[model samples]
Target: MKINAFADVSLRALLVLSSAPAGELLTTQNIADAVGTPYHHVSKAIVRLRELGLIDVERGRKGGSRLSQAGHKATVGQLLRELDTRSDPAECHSSHGDCPLIIECGLRGALARAREAFYRELDGVVVSSLPSFRQMAPVFQTIGLRPGM
Candidate 1:
């Protein structure tokens, strides 16, 4: 149940948006630089998050991104579901018939349970509960935000 690098950046992008003062729209490059993630990955996450209705993006000279209302109240688990972008267990075990143990293995079931438990644990956490970025003073400056934003 490991989060992929894309998902990791997505979560951080949300956290960066969540850190903003209300109504602040942030550029994806700012988030990428602030989180130390590649711009490509961060841009992809931003687009997906926008499509999922968790964030909003507007184009134009003064345009940028901002967390939507749902984003503000998003649970870690919910965001993970949107960003996970992977299957549980393995494709070989589920439908490919690529594994000899597919017929009798309990591994898939166990993995499913473990993944559910992991999400259950994460569900209790709200996005706002993530640590404040205020601790990273240098990043705030680079992101064009004031400290404690």
Candidate 2:
């Protein structure tokens, strides 16, 4: 299944923050530049993350965003679940009006099981275990993103 850009950006942002010293604040634009995502999109994701209690935002001139206390402990699956509301991979009608094979098909159930397995695997990966920009320098370079950008 394909995860959306929002999930990618949010995860990248969290990973970037994880690499920094605890309490180090990163501005929305800084995260956008680092992750090579649109600034506005990062800003919106930041707000959503903040509301989810994964991040904390400070106000004013010296203010920026920092991860919440649980951020490090927050599993990638948790983050994805919070950020990805439409987690279902199967397309089925609630009233059984759209899908003719709702009663006979096992594909939806199989896909759901696969999706759950995928998330279970992702749950084993901690945010702190994510590769840093320095570690992924070659990849960043290949994609034209300068290290530490």
Candidate 3:
């Protein structure tokens, strides 16, 4: 049930962009710094997010990134599904063909159900739901993205 760093950074970047000043473009390096991720990692996440239509990027001297309309409405689960590469809840390690319980064991099904339940819970949470404008203002300020700028 552990989400990878890519998924975590994707959410953080989206949240950061969602809270940024209107029409203000944010650099990926700035975002990476803010989220404590590597430059290349954030860059890759940005590309993936754009490919998913959850974010928009502008190139050139004034190049930067921002959350798109889809991003604004995206649920936590939706983003995770898009960014998380892990498909199976549990790995089948019966390559040796020695395990007899592999075929009948309920562990895999149980894990899948558990993963579904986790996603279901996350579906109720919007990326922008928990951190209020009031809560985000100070954070934005710290990042030099002051309110009303």
- Per-candidate Cα RMSD to the true structure, in Å, reads 2.3, 4.3, 2.6
Q: Which residue segments of model 2 deviate by more than 4 Å?
A: 93-97, 136-149
Give a tens-digit lDDT track for model 3, residues 1-149. 78988888888888888877788889998788767789899998899989999888999999999878887788998888777676556656645654466687798789988877888899978885555677667766666777432
lDDT of 2: 0.74
TM-score of each: 0.89, 0.79, 0.85
Superposed Cα deviation of residue 92, candidate 1 (Å): 2.9
RMSD of 2: 4.3
Candidate 2: tens digits of C-alpha lDDT, residues 100-146: 77786889889888877877878878875676666656544544444
lDDT ranking of the models: 1, 3, 2
- Which of candidates 1 and 3 is the stronger one according to TM-score? 1
Record all residue pairs in model 1 with backbone atoms less than 3 Å apart, i.e. clashing.
none
Query: Clash totals for all models, in order?
Result: 0, 0, 0
Q: What is each predicted model's overall lDDT from 0 to 1?
A: 0.80, 0.74, 0.79
Model 1: what TM-score?
0.89
- Name the top TM-score candidate: 1
List pairs with backbone clashes in candidate 3.
Answer: none
